[model samples]
Target: MEKDILEVERKHLSNVIKECDEKHLLEVEDKFKLTYTYDAVGMGENRIPYEDVKRLSQSKALLEYSEREQKEILNHLKAYEFVKNEAKSTKVFDEEKLKDIHEILVEGIFQGGCYRNVNINIFGAAHQPPDHIKVYDRMAKFFRNLEQFKGNPLEKATYAHASIAKIHPFVDANGRLAKLVLNYFLIKEDFLPISIPLESRETYIAKLEKFKIEKDLTPLTNFFKDLLIKRYEEVLKELDI
Candidate 1:
């Protein structure tokens, strides 16, 4: 959360993931074996790769809130220490949890879950979204159907995130919300939280566009899995976990 050059790092995995690659990111960075645990995924940079992760790793479980909300989210995630059963802690994730996650994120800050009736564009350009009625049903199912995904973690995440963005569920914070939802799944596992930078939004959008239109997740999946592998390698040395 501290501002620095490292904090400003950006990633471009939008190739397969519907959301911007760097929109939500886990800050951990380190080197490790290049092996990846996800399925049928390929890795790339300055290119489309790493669609999304479904392992419930901590990195993808975070909600993207303002500074104050970030603190609240951190506190809430940390509060899991009080729970006796680990699996019970995040296994029952639902919309209420999503709301709570968003609530905590915007706890003392503005730009929270409040939706804007006004129309907006994807990447603030052409692809303008239609009215609420057009997007609501799809958006509602987007989160509801996550439990139905029998695919591997990456596949579910890739599907969920890409679908969410495709619907453009929220008016202003679709990307943030999508990232937050993705991270919530990541945390149920144990990976660190990650994000995409705003400056890199262009590349992120370009890649995201491919996923949106073509429905291909290889690029996004590859980007995230490789990052996770790299992060796992780095943190493995530091935390003895």
Candidate 2:
């Protein structure tokens, strides 16, 4: 029974990652704006976005619902809609465009879409920092890398994921947000979005922790490659090839 449960969880995680990556690639490749989804998820309850919650509510597995071309197009539009509204609604990022982008994703309606001063550990389990100021500075630095940093989307995504985990930003929900930011870069690059499956969370955190302290991304890279292959398979199947 334990083996069965583990196997089922693994399968579900792979599918979720595949669907997410493919759909995000669609957004990037087509140049569709999905900043709203980002802002919503990141900014909302400062937790997971509403759409994700809705997705989960609708289906136990968010990625189980495959997106065809038409639905895929609409999905981009939906994400963009939330992004634009959130952008217009607040100044979370202190930059109009970035705010729009973050709002749609991190802070949407279903969760806690638009509030501030909330705090908690967001990565590798939740441990309160010794000094909040030190933690805040680290968080700020991570975002700075996103702005002043240079690299390809995959490079940026990988780096951002590592940095966020290193900083361990947010009082809570950093893991989810880290991936959202990673997806933001991936979608921006027209590449598939990548995520750590729930089943792989432990391994993901272990590897991410190593990257955080030692700045080694080789293990994470291997993990991402596996996710990419799964996404490619999903896309191929959708085309009925």
For model 1, the stretches where C-alpha displacement exceeds 4 angstroms are 1-91, 108-111, 114-116, 124-126, 197-202, 237-241
lDDT of 2 at 200: 62
| Per-residue error (Å), model 1, residue 204 | 3.3
lDDT of 1 by residue, 1-241 (tens): 6652222221222222233233222222211111121111111111212232221123534343234423433333332221213323745755555555445434454555544456666545434555666665665676567867676665566666667666765543355455555554554554444444434456666666677777676777666565555554444444322
lDDT of 2 by residue, 1-241 (tens): 3553323534554465565666555544333233333332333233444455445434534454433322322333454544334434433332334334334333432232222344544433433333455765666665676767676556667887667556544443444445555665555544555435545656776777667666787787667657655655554454331
Which candidate ranks first by TM-score, i.e. highest? 1
Give the number of the best model, judged by lDDT: 2
lDDT of 1 at 90: 47
Cα lDDT listed for each candidate: 0.46, 0.49
